[model samples]
Target: MTYQNPKNLASIKEISARLDDPNLVILDCTSTVIPADSGSGFAVADGRGAFEAGHIPGAQFVDLERDLSTPSDHLLFTLPSAEQFGNALNRLGIGAESRVILYSTGQPGWAARVWLMLRAFGFENAAVLNGGWKAWTNAGLPVETGAAKARPAASKPFSWTYRPGFFVASDEVVARTEDEALVNALGADSFRGEAPIAYGRPGRIPGSVNVPTSSLVDPDTGLYLSQQQIEKIFADAGVKPDAPLIAYCGAGVAASNVVFARTLSGAGTRSVVYDGSLLDWSSDPDRPLVTG
Candidate 1:
């Protein structure tokens, strides 16, 4: 039912059963990519549009930009403040006891954002739909179209509570750079500034390992790999799961996808996301940076 730790994961059937329960809230976190060619843009749009055309009867759409992230900043989906987040949750009809199952049309990036945010606010019952929406739809479950009313009410009041073992800031990663055990969740190209795709400057933090976040998922299904599979991925990258990991992507969003995978590996590891990621890391001239 409720999962407080990362190690716990549910199958499509189990999550589906929970979705059938009226109390559980299924959130479709399929993101609308700005550039549209990043990865699964068209598919994500189709899934969401299809959801609007027909979803799991009561599922709600959680737009990555509008519902989960702030509109002011362009660096990426950086987290919102506690009050702002509470307001968003309230508008979504989320309460303290709400059981959320976050599913994305793409990989875990979008779902992971909501999961991390829920954990950050100390909501203990949130779970990410394993394999995301694709898995459910592939199973040939029922679908619905058109917007539905918010059941009995419009909004639910909720208060923000700080959650430990949930999130990490950029300075924390910088502090751990000297430890020699930390792994960087960015890609080889961006880590070396060879790609230079980010809005700010490129290049990764000093002494960080290059473990691209995309490596954790199945390209076709957009589902996370098995625990053993992920272990091998990390091992192939020369990373030890037992060590403390600080997952950081361009701006902390993508890295959370990696964190979700690592959590399912049962390594007794805690992965803290570097919230500022490359955006804040590159902006400051004083911070140490390294390139391959």
Candidate 2:
């Protein structure tokens, strides 16, 4: 089956042409933990507030927490129910045949979560917008401000469905901790003996590769590197696209980033995510924690 271009954002000119099509639905995925005044490290910054302030004319707001994801200390954006997903799209005015173009406020990290979830749920027409809000606004495109009332269609067609991924259960993770091939997408500090920010346990999945998902994007451009660059990045991190790779981060958010990238690589290779990731594994006293 032909999946949507994993590198959709690389060609800005081509993607821009589809913006005006009637069958398309653009989503402003900018999300932040704190406002500008608070001086947080990095945040999507009032995503809904920003949407209300200004956004692409036809774009809709997909709140990461409230709308697209479920609340859980073990994981963020753990795929919602198919019915819930269908309702979300319908409420956002997304149609069955609509091509979803997701963009963020210069940060593709958070937005990538939605892109992966939508695709995993069998919505193949979805793609992430390149350069995110910065690209659109920089091009001097038409922008709309203020909240638009949802025009609930009397009978909206619901076609979104969830296709279970090969995600490994925490028990499997615990069992395979000594595999020496599991890849930890979290920070280096966590991979070592040092304690991590999100979990009580310090080390990583035994012998796991370390390639923080944040490294996938160009810091300045907010765009993913080319295919060659992606392959090289993974290779340097000891991640072989051909291997039976397992990706995990503090929660599953970062691991999803790697899944999106590897799927785009198209090498007939597959990687599974440890959905609970470190969150569930670390909290349990029985799960082994390895330190360098």
Candidate 3:
């Protein structure tokens, strides 16, 4: 098998030139954090509102909670059925040969989540837009207002043929964490129990090391860290090259960032994202959470 680096990320300039490519499909996955009434954790910002206001030309808006996730009474953005996800993409005109480019206006992690979702489902042509919306607007690229028309969903039911080894579970967290490095992709504050921000509980899973995905991107540029820089960040977090690593975060979104970064760093083959993350762990009071 051939190796591909930066497998989940792409730059605006690169995608800009290929906007007219028939095989290309671009999606906007912008989402922000909001406050909850109970003050338990957090809520997601309205991606539809943001997309309606402005977006890359010809880019259809994809909702993390709606288009990409399943309807659940308890969870917020759990992964949708493979058929559900495929139909959503099918409606966007994505096909067997389509090269998907995903972006976001807020955190790059949001875009990464979609990229990871597509990747886990055996789709290899998907990638997150580097620097996302901020970089696009800052670069003076054309931004359009209002919604773009989407292609109709396929008449045939989208079948789900899952590709394993892309995700990890809570029980697996306990079973394999000793042998594999568990990286918590949340912020350092949460790592220290100072700001558990979003979750039913306050703290983190036992044996998980903190490697906040935010550290791997430039705040001003919104671009990912360089290879050298990514190496240092992982090193500081006790992550090693060629090691088996599982990334997790609040509700499993930010973990995508780490997963993508690992791919860029040549360790992706042994990396996986814990899909349920803190949302699943924090639910069971029995799950151990340690604070600094």
Q: Highest lDDT: give the candidate number.
A: 3
In model 3, which range of ten residues has the least summed lDDT? 151-160
Q: TM-score for model 3?
A: 0.93
Residue-wise lDDT of candidate 1 within 106-167, one digit each (tens)? Answer: 55677887788887886767878777777778898767778744643324445776666666
RMSD to native for every prediction? 4.2, 4.2, 2.7
lDDT of 2 by residue, 1-292 (tens): 1233554443456556766676767787766644234332222334888788888777778887678766665455566787887788787767766667888784475666777777667777777776677777778877789985564452446477777664667766656533324778766776785632535567786667787776776777766766677778888987665666778876666786677666666532557778777767777877787887
Global lDDT of each candidate:
0.68, 0.68, 0.80
Each prediction's TM-score versus the true structure: 0.82, 0.82, 0.93
lDDT of 2: 0.68
Which window of 10 residues has the lowest lDDT sum in candidate 2? 35-44
Kindly list the per-residue Cα lDDT of model 3 for residues 1-292, writing each as its tens digit: 1224866668888888987787777898877888677766887765888788888888988888878888765566777788888777878887776788998876788888888888778788788888999999999999889887675443442344567787878877888845588999989988877783757777888888899988988989888878888888988888877679989888778898898877876763488888778888888888889888
Candidate 1 C-alpha RMSD relative to the actual structure: 4.2
